[model samples]
Target: MAIGLSREQAPPQAVEHEPVRRRRRPVLVAVIVIAVVLVALFVGWIGIRAVLARQQLEAAQPSASAVVAAMRSGDVAGAKSAAESLSAHAAQAASLTGDPIWRLGEGIPLVGPNLAAVRVVASATDSVAREVVTPLVGVSATIDPRSLKPTDGRIDLARLAAAQPVVAKAQTAFHAAAAGVAGVSTASLIEPVGTAVDRLDSLFAQSSPVIDALGNSTKLLPGMLGQNGPRNILVVAQNPAELRATGGLIGSVALIHADHGALTLQAQEAGTSIGPWPTAVSDIPDATVGIYGPLVGRYLQDANYTPDFPMAATTIAAMWERAHGGTVDSVLTTDPVVLSALLKATGPVALSSGDTITSANAVPLLLSDVYARYPASSQQDAFFSSAAAAIFTKLAAGHLDSGKLLTAFSAAGTSERLRIWSAHADEQKVLATTTLAGALPVSTPQAAGIGVYLNDATGSKMDYYLGASVSAGAEVCRFDFRPTSLVRVTLTNRAPANAGTALPKYVTGGGTYGVPPGEILTRVVVYGPAGGLLAGTQLGSDPVRIVSGTDRARPVAVVPVQLKPGESKTVTVQFLNARQVGPGLNVATTPLPPNAGSTPDVGARTTVARIAHVCDSRVK
Candidate 1:
């Protein structure tokens, strides 16, 4: 019995325990094998989900581009089709990302926020496709461009009235989508997640304003266009050749009347009609008078020395009120390029002078060549009046494709070349929010508001051959000396040395204005942001004389640059008090108003670089 027990019970209990432990090992092994299989499958499923989501997103992007293109071209039906396709593809993408695998990814440590961000953005895009883009398609179809056309010298107010609600509803829906997009948070996300969010950010930024403008147009149209009775509007043509703050000198003016949409050009006048304000406008700011000199009060048209178009418009209205007893509903201001833009849709227009104004040659003929072609001021003035009257008559007669004309108007308005002001307070309130309002930009908070302005000091129209460029950047090369704001403005005189002899005396201001022929004398006025100080100014390697003073509490520095023929020199302006440069660096320049003379060999460029968190830089 003992031997049998030793063999059977274990070589007693020890033997029994050994086999039991062996069985336990196999059970543990089987559990581990099952776990390994599950882990591999789970990892593979997550990887596959990510790849599939990326693929679908890639497919949806092209469709999105098509939708944007169609929408911009006013192809409502095409946009709708494109948007629907985008919605379907985007929905599929969202569904794929909505799977359990992606939900699990949201629990991952480092990549969790990024994964969630992708889903949120995808969903938002899908929502926009449904709520904003789709509705706008119908709105476009509802509002017929031809309805705005005048018949029997009158507009069909009933058509515009019918379309107003459609536009208003679309506006509301677009604003909601913009709000939704604005509400998305991608704070913790990094790299491509942040980049992806930014991709569509500007789309909402631009579309919201456009839709709001369109919506306001629906409301303002009937009243301003005289759907009820009769309305009179003043149109001012600004000549950018002299380079005023807003655009150029006020060279021409016209009075347009719209009675029940029957548009007519009542009278065309030169800038001379309004003459001067008679006395200084009591409301004129001290800084404006100081910068523009006596001209601000001398002539009504010269009051646009401030970059604020509203200020100019208000001054114009008050001055005009003195001459004409009646009040105007609004004032529309446009530059030479605006005329060219309109002509693009209208084809060539024949002026009363028997001169044809084509889009291709409008700028040269009207702005520069006009002076060369007609030396006498009287002849030039007459020709301008005729051109203005001719355009008004043709447009009212519906001689152009209405859609293209609308698009051209849109182009002009967005480019800041076309501006409007309303006498009606309620209408102005709505317009103030849109880009068309033309109000002086509010001072950007914290950051320095450096402004560089150009004024012709030559007492002649010699700015035509002048090229100027301004740039602001951090000069990191000399980092040890407390980082300063480096602003460089370059001006070139491309005229020939004998230009005065070769060009007509009238074109050269008859040598009556100061300076040799072809020489460009410019007063470069550089204003430091509030709290910012001017450190120094340089002409190439040599320092230029800088006269400093206060402009509306902001520091102003004026530098005189007189360039001989074929001379190119750069003016470097340094600013000291840059406590809060902000995270963004602004280098601003406007292409010198499309060059007062030629089509330009080079264009004006404004460079903006964001170099926040740089070592040894003060960016608050």
Candidate 2:
């Protein structure tokens, strides 16, 4: 080995490999630097997209609002312009949210759900802008609500029919958009994202009913308004001063004839004069009679005792036909509140009695003051007839602002102060889906309904001073493996402390019905969702006897509440074994005074599973 030691033999391999390793080190460093730069660029791009998308969404809201406002105000050009702006913002937002890189970012751990929520909102907004508002704006120029106003007592049905198809499409698109937003889960979303999603959900939920009603009206209006033949509709004016289940006791009745949208007042009479029919006017179900009693059939004023408006309208129409000897194709019920709402459009009318009835004084003059001014039934009837005539004359003059008129109809209809029933099966089929139909409480795929109806047991106008509100809830308990739902109805007597001595005898009933003067006896009727069972009822936290019955397959409980002046009471009803549940609950109460705007509270325990979708025995 010593003999072979030379300079080349010492480190030939080391010298050759040193430069190669140095070159490779620089190349590896460059690769890592490039990779880091690429990742940073990707993240930065996503951040910029998110910001732009959010800005687009925020900007679209005002455009959407403007479109709705312009349409309501009958500015078709403004609506179109706003619609275009909405479309632009919504499209860009949708595109930004739908990008592949954005979709990939939706998989990130803590930020993923928020990203997904943003995407969902963007998609829904874009769909609504492109599918719903755009088509509606396209037709807005042709189908003006103002054009539908009565001209010489006739509405132009042709224009309504022309816009029906497009209106129906918009309704369908709206429902789809609503479903898209409703399907997104908010559990994992951050607070801001969850709140934004919830707000969009609420808009869809509230607007669905209005859109549905529009579609239904356009579908049924032509036939119901006598496009095929002449139709006789009975208009029953309900007096809310004396509370009834639907609105109030029928005060005045008028007959209207409709031929191809032309309306004419054919005859007028007091509801009191209709009958005391010798027997039941229509064959009523025993269940109905058991709940409402025979008075509903024999007396026109008692027809609304049943909370079902169709039954009430049927009886009222039958009684009128028997007395007047004419066919009644339909029946409509409205109270003084509705008339006052319409007065805003009709302007002030001078009554034959030299009194001016404006929107401001219509309610008091018609409901409270009229009773005090004319004590006798006949004199009251004369005044009502005169007032009705004066209002009708003003309406016939055709000087109304159509927007205000529609707004009046919407307010009255939503509050249950106005209702309509069609005798024709086809027309009724469409109407049954509407609030105007006045059907009983039933659970749907989207909501569960409970009804709290008030019927006066006092034979007086004392309800003029009554105020009521309703709230409901459900419970879930592990120890108790049964469903339990509770309904609370709070009744307040707003009457003066000296109502016993200060009020008119007619208004107070003079204690004729065994109730003390100024005391209100209300038969409070509570109905649970269809196929539910009544567990128990309480009056002010104490158990009480309830007169129980069933209607439309729903459990009903009747409790009598007697309240003195300046008194308040709360009635509670408990329901068990609900046959169905829905994502939300709706409580339908008797329409109270216009000033009493009740907000319904309905919910279930957060821990329960399928509480909104299934009727589980172990949960409410």
Candidate 3:
């Protein structure tokens, strides 16, 4: 109590003795706070790095082998599930880096193995997932799914993005080229160039979105690495046409390959494998032959034999063998046109002994036999006609035969009676006929009887005969004749004694004539020498009679006559008759009793006198 009086000494003694007790609460609390903060910061940094790394890895993945395998194995649903899980994990990791709540978790020690596994799994999963989703994205990717190979999986986001601009540029160039092509006319040399341009345009239009996405993903690559890096990518075009069209857009990076006999291609980058390249160029327009070969072969097979589809299998086989030096079976699978062409070349082959030729090599044997038996000309014509007919039939039928007929024709050679058989065959086939006027006897006399006979009437049953009297008393005349339902007769008077003869008495004998007398007599028409119709009172009255010294002899005239069924008689008429005038000679006859005019009567005599006078004038 009095320590203040004794000040220093008393106070120091009491202070030490009172309590050696010390509180550790404050220090402990401060230590705990510092430890927590350090842990949080470290955790945050690690998490952020991991998330970023994971994102980078994910973006880099592009290989589709896993996805393809999954799909092939019918694990589509599983693949999708895996993809979703990976996406979620990536998203979670991304959040930990930027968000304060994830700070504690960030400091958690990550085993190197676990981290590497995550990255590997993420990359693999992404590659597969992307492939699975690519088709759903539509046709917007510069890379074709079909052309993609498993090794392409190694392509990182940066490379993919880099390729996008090239693809875009290529697309733009293609469109420009296409525009240039479009400006050209079909006849222009540049017209063919347009086909490539059009294809590129289509590809670019479809792949724009995918290319852009790829580019965006690639853009993120620089951030993923500690330092900027350069990457190289390989682009291969299986088709030369495609390469020519799109190569410019890809700059120097594009590899060009021509799909010829053995699907040849060149790679820009030495590391790329030729095996993955498409065996054929499917995207090019001219590549249709390659793309549709199988389809065409099928069509040929189904084609009708009557129409000769698929031509001949043996013929095709032979051609294939000749072209590629392969056996028939091998050629059939690789090139069906061989069979078709062969069949066509061989014509039709039929076995005289069996349903089919029984030779070890039926097609070749039959072809040899036909060649030996028939002349080249006959074979060619028969084969060609039969082939043509078969094609026509198939076209009309709207379907095809398996080319059995074509094959038969090809093997048989044109010498086979294929044409004859075809004429009677009920199967669909084309029928064609050509008619030419018959030859006339050189000695045939003017005003004499003449007839036309058809040489080949295989399909036709009836006979058609045409008759005409020669002008100027000529013994023969030429004419143009064709098959028809009607018969025509032409008469000309060239007798010096009957220059102005009245219409002659047309006598129909032998066979019952089907012409009416009025029609037979009324159709005579006359023309002046200058090829003008005769005028004045004569007009048509004496169409058959020509007045001598009247602006030269009458010009050639045409007369058309008709006959009634079962009628035969001689029609007597006078030239310049009052009833026959200027385009007024059309007439019909009334049925009369037979033999009524067997003898001459007063009227008949008068008619004859008038005709004689007309004849006399021309004779003078």
Candidate 4:
């Protein structure tokens, strides 16, 4: 036993313990190898799921785009297919993102909230794809928009009444899905994931409202289109040549009566046919009266002198009532641009003057060259009346493409080129929520919208040659600073250099009213951010007199700028909107004629060069 206890030769029990130690090494190595393999497997699994999620998400984008295009084009079948594909992709992404590895990773401290947010967003995408867009697409497919158009020249109110439930259901689904998505927070999300969250938020915000509006419109359209007794609406064709706040002086007017699915175009007359109102004009601001004077209260055609459509509509209704001895249900105003849009579907309309107007030349013919072609206002009025009647006849006969025409009409309203006002409380309720209502947007200390209202000081059709645009840039958007904007409006007169002699006398206003031969006198009214101040104003380096006032509680500046043949002038105004509010600076301008001889120029923009990091820098 003593000999066995030596260093080389230990006792039997000690030798047995050494062998046990050796066995422990092998066991430890085995456990370490297993742990390494397990760790490697888990990491690789996470990598695989992440890559799958990314691929699914990336693939979902174009499918979403296809759905949007289909929605716009009224291609319901395409929308459904694309939405289904998107739903599949979203489901796959959600599955990959929700796998065990990612679930465990979601509990890690720094990345936990982000991963959870990713899950929430993925779930929202799946819901929106499956629940929100698909149902709407189904409704769109069921409702033949062409059926909504009057086939016998009358709106089928029964058809509209029947489709109401479909639209309503779609609306409800959209809002529910949108609300669920809105409940999710993406504030802590990271990188591309955060971007997706933002996009989905925007899509819901946008898509839901549109469907909501559609539902609301459909709810009221049937009754308004004459489900109840017959409805009479005064249709006014405004002339962009004699630019007024809304468009131009009423070039023509027609009494249109609708019953069931039938449309009757009654007596048609030119602006000259409308007499002065029997009652005194109401709601005329002192500023408008200051410039337009007694003329503002006299003529029904001049009702649009004020930029407010509701006020003008009331005055127009009053005038129509006074002249015809009864009030109308509504007043519908459209310009050459809208006419051009209509022509695209109705085909070429031949005028009694032996001239044919297609969509390509309607704007130019109505606004510009008509003066050159015809000297007398009576002749011009006759041409307009003929064009209108032709379109009415074609639409009444259902000879044109109804879907294309309806879409064009919709596009016009969305562009704010088509404005309608209803005297009926129910119809007004429907219109209030749409741009078609043409109500000036309300601006607050936090959010402000811009208005560019123009009036013809020339008493001529010179506005046809006028090109106008506006650009807005923030003076400072720094932290803790009150955000201000500097807006620049440029007016260009593209009248021929020899406008006085080379152009026809009628085209240049025929030197009537003793005005300058080629000068375009424009009364430029700039409406700044609703609650913002008019910091200052300048016209081409010269200080112009700025007359400040409020239109329906919104601030406005009336500054007049004149341009001669081939002349361009720029006007600059500074304003302060909500300190850190949205939409930056919303600019609303009068829509230009879409079918001019050359490009009809009118646009709005936001610039960064004038964006000041500090609060005090100028936008120059």
How would you order the candidates by TM-score, starting with the best?
Answer: 2, 4, 1, 3
The candidate scoring highest on lDDT is 2
- Per-residue lDDT tens digits for candidate 1, residues 1-620, read 33444445654233457888989999999999999998788777766766776677778788888977886676777887888888787777677677777788889887787777677667667666666666666666555565565555566766666778777776776677566556657677788877777766767786665677677878888888988778888888887666666666788777788887778887677886676755765367767776566667657667776665677788777666666757777888887677787787688998777789977778888777888778787888998888887777778777777777776777766666677888889878877887677653333433455666676666555666777777675433233333446667788887778877776665555556667777777777776655656667777889777666666656677788889888988877766544443422343333265654444211123333333222222222
Off by over 4 Å in 1: 1-59, 66-77, 92-107, 143-198, 202-224, 227-231, 437-448, 475-483, 511-513, 539-548, 551-553, 577-583, 587-620
TM-score of candidate 1 against the unseen true structure: 0.80
Give lDDT: candidate 2, residue 166.
91
Give a tens-digit lDDT track for model 2, residues 95-151: 989988888888999788788889999999999999899998998765666778888
TM-score of each: 0.80, 0.84, 0.18, 0.81
Better of 1 and 3 by TM-score: 1
Per-candidate total of colliding backbone pairs: 5, 0, 47, 3
lDDT of candidate 4 over 44-65, digit per residue (tens):
8776877787788788889999
Which 10 residues in a row give candidate 2 its minimum summed lDDT?
A: 600-609
Residue-pair clash count for candidate 4: 3
Put the candidates in lDDT order, highest first.
2, 4, 1, 3
Model 3 lDDT tens row, 1-620? 33354455554553463333345566678899999998787666665676675564444332233433454354656545545554454444434344443444424354333333333333333332343243322222323222121121122233344444544454344344334333433222133223433443453455443333333323332222111332111221111000111100011112112111111112221111111222321121222222122222222221111011113222223322333342222101111112233334334334323323221333232222333344443442354234323432332232323233333332222111111111111211211110000111111111211111111111110001111221211111112211111112232211122211221222111112433222222232222222222222122233433222111222222233332323222212222221111211211111110121121110110010101112222211
Decide which is better by TM-score, 2 or 4.
2
| Candidate 2 Cα RMSD after full superposition onto the native fold (Å) | 6.5
Better of 3 and 4 by lDDT: 4
257 Cα displacement, candidate 4 (Å):
1.2
